[model samples]
Target: MADTTQDYTPGSHPDLPPPSSEVGVIGWLRHNLFATPLDWALTILAVYLIYVLVVPALDWMLFSADWAGETRDDCSREGACWVFARVWSKVFIYGRYPVEELWRVNLTFIIQFVGLAALMIPGVPYKKWTGIFLLIPYPIIAFFLLYGGAFGLEPVETSLWGGLMVTLVIAEVGIVASLPIGIVLALGRRSKMPIIRAICVAFIELWRGVPLITVLFMASVMFPLFMPEGVNFDKLLRALIGVAMFSAAYMAEVVRGGLQAIPKGQYEAAQALGLSYPKVMTFIVLPQALKLVIPGIVNTFIGLFKDTTLVLIIGLFDLLGVVQLAATNPDWLGFAVEGYVVAAVGFWIFCFAMSRYSMYMERKLETGHKR
Candidate 1:
């Protein structure tokens, strides 16, 4: 044993730092951006493109942009006239909702903000109750607050509801209303009953086949012709219904895809345990299916949010629509670009938030199942 036998053991030696060219920012750049000739070329090309396009855009948007001003006359034509956005900010948010009763709108926004914060933020207690409050009573409260014919409040017409307020209302209603409808459709599509399946398939296809704009148009126009003579639907109501139905069709397909991904063994196992169809679906299948389809569901929601802008065609001004309308004002003329930029930024923020939330949910769910 004492003979010249050298000890050789992995990890016995003190760990030395990795090479400078293989571990830090330079290493990352080398591995990811310059790993090969093609990567190097692409990295250089991307940088050049960004410099050519984004740098000047940033300069125009930030450094050169006019921020402090009261009117279009105060703006210099060399850069963006953000004063247009500033002057019309209230109009962009509250639209034609009377200035004297703006408190109701402000209150509704406050309540919603609190409710959403409770629901989304971690460690909030009694979340189920909070969710129920948001899902059921909050909508009624919001409607009354915004519409305000009840509770001795002044009545604001649906026509007065435009801008970000209307946009959010339509989007929230569509999102909340569509999910359950979509789930039912998806289940019906997969049902063993031929009649149910046929009806679901027909409904989904009918909505999905047509463009959303056409659906909105029909809801605003042709839909009322079939109704009773004295009964008239609010244009915003029609648009909301149309948007919900249209989104539900797409949502049904997404949910159905998730349903199909579940292994047959799981269903058989649930049945073996003496679970009924509804029980199995509620307790096991739907939970898994919905989790699997979070990305698709959120994608649908983002699209639906953006599609609220299309309601402008039906004469319901959403956020973008309001901005466009404000831009046309005689005093604010020639600032259409600034208004559009504001709307674009607003949309991007919402869409990006949704996307990030989707990613967070995915990571939280730890959906590691193999497809």
Candidate 2:
């Protein structure tokens, strides 16, 4: 007897045509840019805007640009004067950080890169513990490296630290220090105890309600009054405290949102399993909550990074501060556009890369919630 069952092939569909050549670039454009009248209109508008902005930029940055030679005087062209940039590149990157001690900053960058790379790798066992260790000791190591008061190295004051180096230090320290403090605040805000919740709420609200500049001012000027008569805090330390406190307030709100998003079922289930509140939070709820809000956390970090530039307002030299300083230099005068453009590009690249990484992490950690 012959079998009458229909046959199934694992491969291609016989009824469908082979993939079309137009389905790549042309198809993508058609679908995304010309799918409907509205899309087409938007695409045209975007193209026009791009042309309006980019054409002139290209002309200034490349076509009529002066890339070679020394001094602004050499470039008599109508394009961007990058000669000024070339002359003051070190000042923009390192500020007044001594030329001889530049190696220390470079070494700090190397260590930070290595540590971050290690933390990012998923295959590393005990990753959480490793991250904790990196987080805890990094400030101390970075401080010693940058300040250089120990190990027979000459003492470098915070006032001398400027440029991107200061920006990175402030941002990194703020984010790291704020995280745990934020976590505690978030927990307190949701705590059963009225006093704890009230205190947390007040702290978060007070900090968030005020502008960061005012906080920085307080840190720089008012903090000295609060200190003991003979002792004085470093300007950088004061700025760090201001940034950390401001960041913690915002971070607390972000973490609280994460906590609210977590299902009550998870909390009850953890309790049902005879686990303590801390254990439940650490082992079950917080992991899920944090994963859910990773993007928000990264956004906060990006904001903090950008805000670190504001230290210039309180007389602390950061990346933007250094750029402003270079722009006003008598030797390289009348090059504000070049200096600002460089700083803006640097900031854009850093923030853009961080935003992209956050998106990647979100996708990498996404798990289907289908029941």
Candidate 3:
């Protein structure tokens, strides 16, 4: 009978073995790029194609490009007209806004940058308060600053706002305003009340069914017809509202998907402890749902940002709009490539930053992997 009971203790290990050489950087390149004859052939062909395309472009843009020029005449046909970029950089960034008032844009951007960075950093304190300020007082302050009628600042019409400033405002407002509205709409769509469900469903479907460009056109053109004859709204403001509403519809769908992913037990458990619907959602359900749908939310955000370029159609001079205008200027004629390249780079940087941040948050919030 001695030692009949099995020893149940599992042994613990002190160290993780280093990954084999076959899994290191060199090994990774070998496995992914050059593992077999066909892989090697494809890799070589790809690299050769890349070099053929990239080297000449690099040479033209960098080594042979005009670095200093006074006018289009100074630019050589053989290389990139970099001088155009240098001269019009400010115009690209600030649009046709009065150069003297550029500091206001700078100030707004700096405040937004610092505030958003602080909020995004994991360990920063007072985030809830910061968010409150952003949603509440921040918009009022920004509106006055950007469209000043009081505080001794001369009023600048929304028509004067353009370039990166216009782009950022449209995008940021859409993002901040859409999230909470989307959540409410998502919850309403799932509500037990028939009227609430129908309204939410109709709202979401109506917006989502239409193209955003149509919404913008309506905001720019038809929206005025609906308003009182004397009363008016800023064109930019109208565009912002249109963009936010359109984005919220898509976001509601994303949020609804996340809400549905939540387990029935979560709802039942929340109810068993005497939690109300709002309490159950705010404390237990929403956090998990939002966490699950971060990728979709970020995708919507990126699409929303890119969609801001369409503001050009409505006569707003966003970054791309300004670039198009600048490319046709007498002094910078035929430099559409230069202007387009700069705009493409700017857009890529912003979109790439957002995508990377989403990935970081996803990894940070990951709870368990499905087997």
Candidate 4:
């Protein structure tokens, strides 16, 4: 009955050694990159290729690139003209928007950023109120501020809006509007009611079957013809509607995939607990379904964001459109590569940030071990 448990000493195990770079870095490299002579050779080859590609790209971007000098002549023929992208930054951001009225756009972005930050915080009190402000009142206020038909503010036409402002607006509005619309469509598609299910199926199929360009074209040309005489719609409004509808169709399919992934047992369990169909769906199925499909939803959003540039084909001057327009300027001749590179970099940053967020959300919500 005396102490039978052996006193264990630290570092007593002979099988395991204290961790070091060899077991960590070297071990990983050996297994992943240089386990065999062929792997080592391939790894060396890859390094050589990266260096070969990156050095020239870096030289073109920085070492030999023009950082200053107003005229195109100041730019080195051997490297990029970064100064062009710098000087046209405002044009990229605001498109054709009047410089004097840029305060309106700035204010709208400030409000939106602040509101979204507050909403994302789990500890925020009065979330319902915050949602009301962000969803309802904020849009109305932003609209008046942007359009400026009231309170002695000069009215700015939608045609005047361009650049990153229009791109972001189209993306944001399309994503926000599509989510609920998609949810409804998904639910309807899954419903027991024959009429509801059939209607949802047809609607989803019709929209999904058509390419987005066709939808945009229809919105720009055909929508006007369908409208009553003297009932005019803003071009931006038409594009926004088109983007939203096209996105909603894709989102509906993504959400339905998530919904379909939910187990039958889960539905049965919810129903057995005296829950109606709505309660079961809302409280049990949907939360899990949406969580499961966060990546899909984000991918859809990123695609929609990138596709906002397509509106330029219909006369809207989104960020890419502005760049194209700038290329035509006599003063800024022959700088298309600089403009396209900057635009591509801008897009890559936004899309990369979104992909990182999706990964973070997936990790944060993970409930089980991944194999």
Kindly report which residue stretches of model 2 are placed more than 4 angstroms away from their true locations once superposed.
1-45, 124-130
Tell me the tens digit of each residue's lDDT in model 4 across 152-222: 87899988888888988899899989999999999999999999999999999999999889999999999
For residues 1-371, what per-residue lDDT tens digits would candidate 3 score against the true structure?
57765555567534566668577897899889989999999999999998999999898888888889777778877888888888888888887778777787787788778888888999999999887787798888887888888898778887887788888889999999899899999999999999999999999999999998999999988888999998788899899999999999999999999999999999999999999988999999999999999999999999999999999998999999999999988866789988898899888999999999999999999988433
Q: Estimate, for each residue in 285-341, the C-alpha lDDT of model 2 and write its tens digit.
A: 889988988999999999999999889999988888988998898887777888889
Better candidate by TM-score, 1 or 4: 1
Candidate 3: clashing residue pairs, number: 0
Model 4 RMSD, rounded to 1 decimal: 5.9
**Top lDDT prediction, candidate number:** 1
User: On a 0 to 1 TM-score scale, where does candidate 1 land against the true structure?
Assistant: 0.91
Estimate the overall C-alpha local distance difference test score of candidate 2: 0.88
What TM-score would each prediction reach against the true structure?
Answer: 0.91, 0.88, 0.89, 0.88
Better of 1 and 3 by lDDT: 1
Q: In order, what lDDT does every prediction score?
A: 0.92, 0.88, 0.89, 0.90
Candidate 1 contains a number of clashing pairs equal to 0
- What RMSD, rounded to one decimal, does every model reach? 4.4, 6.0, 7.9, 5.9
Top TM-score model: 1
* Residue 97 shift from truth in candidate 4, angstroms: 0.7
Query: Candidate 1, 119: how far from true, in Å?
Result: 1.5
